[model samples]
Target: MTCDYDVVIIGGGIIGSSLAAHLASEKNEKFKIAVINSTGLGMPASEAAAGLLTPFQLNELENPVRKDFCFKSFEYFPEFFETITSGSSAKHIDLGYRQAGSLYLIFSNSEFSQKENETRNLKTIEPRLSFLSKVEIPKYEPLITRDVIGAYHYPSEAYINNPKFLKAIYLYCIENKVEFLNTTVKKLNISSNIVENIVLDNGQVISAGKFVFCNGVWANNFLKEIFNTDKNIIKAIRGEIICVKALHAMPLRKIIFCSNGYMLPRPATNAFETDSVLIGSTSDEVDLDKIQPPLSNTVSGISSLINLFKTLVPDYKDYLVSGCWAGLRPQTKDNLPVIGKIPEIENLYCSLGHYRNGILTGPFSGKILKDLILENSTEYNIEPFQINRLFETQIRGIPKYASI
Candidate 1:
């Protein structure tokens, strides 16, 4: 069947772009697919993210979709990297993927409870997770705070340069002949409960057989009004981070976290290896209009992290920071993303509300969204993150907190 366009995807972030790439890669027939975005991927929270792709969780097994996709995507990065950086001469610009593994430490009561048997079920979460004691700490994480008592490792997950990852998707999409429309979608041109096309900000209309909404944080308002569905699937949260020229040699290998803050290795080239530790972030849930967080808040957030680092690793006491920022993460009420087509709106899908896991689950999120559009079985279950889950209940006026 000759179709005008196979799909019209909204939002060119990691999720949308990845989906476009995956769809084209898996295309058995010709497909005219287009991806639209306001600011594109890695622009806000995704770009400012620590880019730690791990299945490491505090137990109870978070959204199964996210967990499964995280591991799947981790295994998929090497190939994705090769495909995207095949011709780029610039070394650092090439997909910055490093399988440094992740080190998850357990501290405090609630934190301990959640992480207690997590390592035991490490195989379920991540096959490579192993317990580490004080003695083994130095061998693994030499620069980490000496106060670290309990920890585990997940070697499968890789730390990514998120911006490059997004760029790679852009390259992959362009390479695959996926069209990009750099505009915000005003509304779904829906009639009789079917999304026929999308109205752009400038009144230009584009048609599609399948419509996927991958815009984070901004999806809620769109959903409520477009479908008249009051499902609160996205929670806007602000995260503050500081790029301290890794300030210290830093015993941390993959990702390090204490009570106050967590840090990840920066990807972009910097003056010093120790100078590029991406220290973050204050997880403050706020309204969409209040998306931009305060710089003072970012500074204080870094300071708090420094204080905690001092207690854990005294070497980071007088470190100098290079950059500081705050970004928004689109969390959901259930702390899981919504990643399937809305039953109410046929051919209209959603892969949003990923919050901090956009980098971790970005690739797989794209993979699954592709499967849904192509009518193939997804690699993992999609029920957990169904967009309609929250709307099942009448959630009234109480504010909620963000979950990591």
Candidate 2:
């Protein structure tokens, strides 16, 4: 089949946008690229994330490959932001990029001992990390409650304003001449395991030499519909976050992580005047059929977060509730992302199932996908993230705090 474009990327989230930006920026504008999305950029999880970039907090013992990938991606953020902002007309975009560090609070003596043992090894991986005693913890974050215990402070960790970053990438892609179609992909017309064309819901058939799916949880349905393979690779895990205006005399200086949940302090910006903090999230693995929004704002979820805040900070009652929102994370069975070519399909690729760290790892995932598409050599081995691995073992449910 003759192709209209060299590549058709489905999904306008961060991953897809990053891939389009990278591919469009190639020398000579070699490839014709189109990005298709049902909703515009930052829809779903991309916009609803806390934008924490601390990969070291993930469970390295269980999924070392994902941990390594996230760490490398976290390291690439500074340069990635610079490149996207420098190339686009939107030079003054504020990404809320901050290296304010993260504190993982410990509440019990047993937990403190465990962290102490882990810290010895963590120092080798993250040299700037330190174990702060209960007395020292308040010195860093004065608002923290005097709940008798210690904490681990990772000074190298950081965060970004995810929504702004997504917008910047979209603008950067446009500046680089990447076309975008605001539509839904109805089907993939495949013959002999090679996708020949993509059928849209509007009755338009688009042809592309190559196709990449970055559509998050929707990819599972797409795969089942196209291949008739019920490989349950991606599941939608709903996470609800609450945003509140900070009432503290001094704003939270760093990311605060506790056993129950974590909070991110977003400083006042030109767009939003009041300094606010995000308290999240409830990871509920709901049935895909019931995944539609009005994603139930339960009293239990909100109350749990409130109680956690009260436990962590004495002045938790001071912060007034602003609003609450929810997004479905494309969590994989193994808690690792699916980011490679399908074994049975040629010219078809996937970069989905990023779960909680999508924003953190999206750029590096894009680079990896680009390298795979262009057949360029990559420094990291991506074998562990392949789709075939799901068939090899029983898919396990990831705990809510597995990555924390």
Candidate 3:
């Protein structure tokens, strides 16, 4: 009764790839691991993300639990990347990791006053946090529009190239002999509260000692299929982003945050590469099944993003439009990520509903899940992100804003 693989991980996005990297990095024993992706590698949200790692600016630090979760993940980035890139071919991959800091633009005096007080208190936690005057904003980012009144700056915030980060981890897993199958899991074979194996779309049955679902928005379908519940646990929030390239090298100094959207520099990886900026996003709730990958950007979405670009850097209005794309982010009713073993299914686990923090939290979440899979214990307190808590809470209507 030997299993084909020690672990079969469903989904190949950042979450799944990070988990694969973690499992592959195990020093004690080599586990037979497989990562299955229905969509192409790094297809949606992972690649489509603006890659802005500004957890402190967006009311993320308001909640103690969420603040701790995000900050811990933020601090773990260097070590996570180090571990994955140590022996992999992706060591040379430019993950676009930047610590240039993040700025939140202010349009009015009232808004400035409000943030001034907010930053005053936040400074206790982040000593470097400050509100830059309109006269001083240009010193940090000269390309910005003159219409901006001021901005709130968090010097320690950082960002990364989401796609390359995913690629780095994928390569690490491949280098460690983790198998990747580009296919969909059609069903699961559960017997007496334990998952025996997974059934693929082609009717191929693959046995595995353990199963982990990191399929993002698609987890809802799997949940309903496995638990036989009609409740909607995971919601798909579609986001659209546009990339604009400057004719000349107009390097952006820091990430920009505005009421309408955000702007971040997409640094040139090579000498021949030109400077570009990524502007995002519009959040629209869509049905789980409604999203077919290769998502297109709408005229309205593009126009809105363009307006954001113009408002942020009016001087860059003539910049070339390089590309536009969309992605679906998975979120739970509570907006906290789900990361733990499924109590009902002995060998089943999940790391879904990451929403906006997937890029920031993926690696640590993977570490936590890996610990739970091996020893049923973890260093971090994931009690708030448990799956059982989701089932205990009643389903609620989708909020006006899913994630910030």
lDDT of 3 at 201: 84
Taking every candidate in turn, the Cα RMSD to the unseen true structure, in Å, is 5.7, 5.3, 4.8
lDDT for each residue of candidate 1 in 279-346, tens digit (9 for 90 to 100): 76688776665443332345556677556556655677546667777677888877777888776555
For each candidate, the alpha-carbon lDDT, in order, equals 0.69, 0.81, 0.82
Clashing pairs in 2: none
For model 1, state the Cα shift of residue 278 in Å. 0.8
Q: State the lDDT of candidate 2 residue by residue for 66-157, as single tens digits.
A: 77888889988787888898989767866688899999999898977776776686688788898888899888888887786788999988
Q: Which stretches of candidate 2 lie over 4 Å from their true place?
A: 40-43, 392-404
The full ranking of all candidates by lDDT, starting with the best, is 3, 2, 1
The better-scoring model by TM-score among 1 and 2 is 2
By lDDT, the best candidate is: 3
Candidate 2 has a TM-score of 0.92
Per-residue lDDT of candidate 3, residues 69-158 (tens digit): 888888887799889877788877777888999889999989877777767766887898887888998889888887878888899888
- TM-score for model 1? 0.83
